[model samples]
Target: MSQGPAPRVLSDEALSELLGGQQFGTLATNKRSGHPHLTTMLYKWDPEARVLRFSTTADRIKVKQLRRDPRAALHVSGGDVWSFAVAEGEAEVSEVTTVPGDSTGQELLAMVRGSVDPADEDAFLQQLVDERRVVIRLKVQRLYGTALDVNG
Candidate 1:
């Protein structure tokens, strides 16, 4: 049985590039009572270090759920492009105390916004920061990404 991570058919660079499309995926975690909690999110598969990082509002049930438990799973897919990635790990919560430069700034900002509402995203973000929603970092232990062969 091919177990633990995915087959390394694609190189790290290819995998990273594949994951760079910013696919909106679902995240799942377990509660103390064994109930599963799931939330939609935007994520990136950092192939260099094989880390999956994502952002979410701290006040959300997902965040609260994480506080109760750290285990997490992410499902990422990018349309008909035939790319998908899955990751499992311990979600670490912290304040995103750093800002990005021009290149990454837009992406980072988009992530922050995507985590919340658009009507008052800034206020929501500020509230998130005030309420400490600044970061939703997940430290992955196991990950696997495969380029789905639709024809197969």
Candidate 2:
């Protein structure tokens, strides 16, 4: 009998690539009971700043959880079942967008603009306010993951 190949530890570059290559990931926040609250979210990863940004409603439970406990982690798939990465950090939830074109709104604008350029920028900004949205900035402190060498 032969032992199977162990999962290969992903390098810093590989981990960053995996995180930046994908826009959707599982965001985990700590609940009051010390349990992990998981949410599937669309996020923007800034490799240079080591920050992950997410747009969410202010009334959402995740926002409440993050406000109470800033610790959070995001898990992103490496475009395959055998590879993945996790970014752990502290989250700072921005104030709900009350006025369009405000700082929080602007941050949301940048995150949305990364995916699609809204034709009506004003409408987009206003919509964010209407939805009571806020931006969550996760300052990534550590990144670690692994990839399995299946073919090897």
Candidate 3:
């Protein structure tokens, strides 16, 4: 199998930076009625595979819509720094990875540091898991954005 695209659209380093920037984007999915549903999310980037992964509830409206139609788009932009990344492609939702409440708590705290307290980690995780359902991995089939045509 091919290791990657003919020309790496986004370098591994750049992808990692994108993730570290904590730059969230509005993920838009088509509802059954053919309207859009948007939501904010934090993503994990896998450099070697060049994939972006994020989690959401299985019963979420967006997730349900995605099941009906896999097409979706991600709108990412920055203000402090003038930048943007817009990607449109298909999405896949994995079976919920049953992580322990404490582990999920730690991951959440890491994502939003001081906002959460160490003491309430377990309780918060349990609450979140009880509410949300699945983990989503978005494989970007086409990525287009500012600062992307450096070589061209």
Candidate 4:
């Protein structure tokens, strides 16, 4: 087999940029049998918090797996040039709570306002609230990525 070129290490800034721009990735969670269960998901990166978060319903298998085993990995890849990154982290799942008596679903609103039409914001928020989504926060323990060329 022909060997490929050595992968160049990505810097913290580069990784953060790639992560923030990546809207989707595969989340790897451990099933009870210790096998990997992979789920393609949409994620939001919080650079300031240094964590990655994704929304999913409370009853999802990934949530159950995470609750049982907090250890997880998120593999994100981007760039037509073939760049990829893997973040190994511990996860914490929490039920999303809105302010009491605030029927607007603040968290959901913030997440969808950019994509949903302004006039439909309320309806979208309501739909999200009805889903009872839980936010899974991944506390990155180690982040490493490689690209064909970092400067590219």
Candidate 5:
């Protein structure tokens, strides 16, 4: 009998690439009941800053959970079934955007617009205010992942 190949620990660069290359991931926040609250989120990865940014409504449960416990983990798929990555960090939620064109609104605009500007900048800002949007900044402290060697 022969033993099967074990999963290889992915390098830091590989992990960062996987996280940065993808826009969606599962965000796990610590609940008051000592369990994890998971939510599928669309996020922006800043490799240089080692931070993940998410734009969400201020009234969301995830926000409330994070407010109680700042610890969070983001799990991102590595473009294959055998590959994946998890980023653990402390999340800081911004104050809900109240006035249009405020700092929070501007940051939300950048996160949503990326390199392009929205068709109606004022309308976009107004919408951010109306939606009670907040930015969750996850400052990644540790990155770890593994890839299984299925091809022998």
Candidate 6:
């Protein structure tokens, strides 16, 4: 049997556009036992900064895992098609400090809130702040993806 055509590769511009949307992605991290721990995440892709930002609370297991091991992978896919992207990188965790209000943290939160719920942004922002949420900054070492037709 013939193996299908080679997977189509996505351009940098295309990958940037795809990640800029409000779609959720699956973030993969390593657990203490060396098993893969995955969770659905809302991410902010900053092409200029070459980093991906995601939020989680301090009590979350992923946060602890990442604190112990910075390695992570974030995968975003198109629901209607076979297109997908993978970002492999190291993570840095920072608690959102509302007292002093970290500039980078504020900006990241705004980007995430704006994308996820612009209509009710105030409530969402407050909830994030109240929850003691932390931001995960992924410094991307590699990026690869495909935007290919499945039926072709």
In model 1, the runs with Cα more than 4 Å from the true position are 1-14, 81-83, 95-132
lDDT of 4 by residue, 1-152 (tens): 97767778899888888899889999999999999999999988888878888878878999999999999999999675568788889999876544421433565455554787888866666666677767788998888888884342
For model 3, what is the C-alpha lDDT against the true structure?
0.63
Which pairs of residues collide in model 3? 57-133
lDDT tens digits by residue: candidate 1, 96-150 = 4333223233334555556555666555445434444345667766656766544
Tell me each candidate's RMSD, in Å, in order: 7.2, 1.4, 8.3, 3.3, 1.6, 3.2
Per-residue accuracy of model 3 over 1-152 as CA lDDT, tens digit each: 64532332455355445544655778889987788888987665554565666667777887878788888887666333335566677888765435545444444445455666878766666766676546566777766544322322
Residue-level lDDT tens digits of model 6 in 1-152 = 98876778988777777777645899999998899999999888888888998877878899989999999999998555578888899999986645323563466557655366656655666676677778889998888899766684
Could you tell me the lDDT of residue 7 within candidate 5? 87
lDDT of 5 by residue, 88-150 (tens): 999999999999999999998888675546568898899899999999999999999998888
Model 3 CA deviation exceeding 4 Å by range: 1-20, 79-82, 97-129, 147-152
Worst 10 residues of 5 by lDDT: 110-119
Candidate 6 local distance difference test against the native: 0.79
Using lDDT as the measure, what is the rank order of every candidate, best first?
A: 2, 5, 4, 6, 3, 1
Pairs in steric clash, model 5 = none
Rank by TM-score, descending?
2, 5, 4, 6, 3, 1
Q: TM-score, each model?
A: 0.61, 0.95, 0.62, 0.83, 0.93, 0.79
Per-candidate total of colliding backbone pairs: 0, 0, 1, 0, 0, 0
- Please say which candidate is ahead in TM-score: 1 or 4: 4
Q: What's the C-alpha lDDT at position 151 in model 1?
A: 46
Please tell me which predicted candidate would have the highest TM-score against the true structure.
Answer: 2
lDDT of each: 0.62, 0.93, 0.63, 0.80, 0.93, 0.79
Which parts of model 6 have CA positions greater than 4 angstroms off? 1-3, 96-105, 113-126, 150-152
Candidate 3 global TM-score:
0.62
Model 4: how far residue 137 lies from native, Å: 1.2
